[model samples]
Target: MESSSNFTPFLLFLSATLTVLSSVSANSEGDALYALKRSFSDPDNVLQSWDPTLVSPCTWFHVTCNQNNRVTRLDLGNSNLSGHLVPELEKLEHLQYLELYKNNIQGVIPPELGNLKNLVSLDLYNNNISGIIPPSLGNLKNLVFLRLNDNRLTGPIPKELVGPPNLKVVDVSNNDLCGTIPTTGPFEHIPLNNFENNPRLEGPELLGLVPYATNCS
Candidate 1:
């Protein structure tokens, strides 16, 4: 029964709210990426385009975004970068492909990376990374390829990795990993060579013959 003009103010308020939300989302994503830029030693200025003053990381080089301006991929492989990864990377909720392979990056793989539920491929091979494979990575139900070979990592591969239903490929060889290889799930079809070369890692376990925990001790 009221006049239609009365709705104008409410509609304007709603529009402004949405704009603010979009800006905040963009800025937060930018901040998270900028934090990473600060953590790395980029000799080639491959990250020169990562200006934190920008409205969105979508405009940055090596960063891919979806139609909604949400980060989807980060391709910084082989860029001569050397530094640890930042935990802030978990903020990219829509991230899928995280490729930082064949670099000189050191330090542990941030456990927070497991929070990226949409992640598909995680390639950190041929780096200087050293740490346990985070069990938290089991949360990535959408993961497909995970390559962490040729690093200095030392620990048993978390059994949780065996849970991702879509995981088709995994290579953790040439590390210092200790323990029997997981025989279930995606590992069942994976080539044995993919898990070889770790001096302490053993088994495609013989059921009832060699227990799964035989080597870790």
Candidate 2:
């Protein structure tokens, strides 16, 4: 058998290869974040630390990462940010908390957000976001807190939202939403006040009495 010393060169090469791969993964995540930074109008420079030159976005403020340097939480709430969210946000495969509440963020919520299977809390309240709530959000089975209240959103709440078994709190009040409020599954425990202020929203969905989609248009 060959001496152990013969493996030294092979081991060194393997180590270098791994280092390069780790750098590449970090850069990919950094790129996705930079895309978000570019899309926002940060007058307060809250995203100044989100430099693409860095090896990883973990160094950026408002971003939290795991032991493996994968992004998990983004706390940019109340940062005085405007502009819409980017679809590239779906690239954060390990992301859990996405807090962008109390901002001036406009435009529709990206449907790509539904791809974050590990997500738990998604707070986008008090923004100017409009458009129908994406049905794709039902894909997040791990979700718990979902607050989209105080926006300009229209259309019925997607029925697929009931799929998340861990969902505890959901607020969609103060919006332009129509359709009967869902009463099954996770929506059973939701407070009536949470569903208040929606002038067009019909009361709880009565089973077998009328279609839930009635006059929802």
Candidate 3:
């Protein structure tokens, strides 16, 4: 009987430990997002609700959480936000959709974003963002929609971006990108016009065909 009573205490201790760990994870996500908030110039106070002291970032506006209280979506599209993105965003392990389109954000896409394995959609279209498309983005196996149009981005579209299994929509048009468009994996189905408007971009690569100016200057 005494052994069984001791097992009860152990169960209670384990439960408390788990609760503490859960709180830590939640706080970490909040801290990462707050860091980004400090970096941006929000003209409309869209991020006013992002108070870190709350129980979890799940309560913050423009943020969405899963049933497990982990951040999964960050929808801040068209809020007129300007400022460079922060690599701290990579800490949102459960993040899926990161939408910040139609803003004036300027900077290179963070290579650290490649660590977001659960990412689904990465939309940054109609912005002034510039810099090479990070090859690290290819690591997001679940990525689907990739919109980076109307930006000043330069360099070859990373061949890695074409390999994500779930990629269905790719819009890098109207950018300064060069090099041959990929023609394999999910790339085979992406429309040709999506590659248009960029004067330096070369021919749409077919299977085994050489890419247009693979090495962009």
Which scores greater on lDDT, model 2 or model 3? 2
How high is each candidate's TM-score? Answer: 0.94, 0.93, 0.95
lDDT of 2 by residue, 47-123 (tens): 99998999999999999999889899999999999999999999898999999999999999999999999999999
**Candidate 3 C-alpha error for residue 204, in Å:** 1.3
Off by over 4 Å in 1: 1-3
Computed on alpha carbons, the lDDT of every model, listed in order, comes to 0.91, 0.93, 0.91
Which model, 2 or 3, shows the larger TM-score?
A: 3
lDDT (10s digit) by residue, model 3, range 41-100: 998999999998886899999999998899999999999999989999999999999999
RMSD of each: 1.6, 1.8, 1.3
User: Which pairs of residues collide in model 1?
Assistant: none
Q: How accurate is candidate 3 locally (lDDT)?
A: 0.91
Estimate the overall C-alpha local distance difference test score of candidate 2.
Answer: 0.93
**Using lDDT as the measure, which candidate wins?**
2
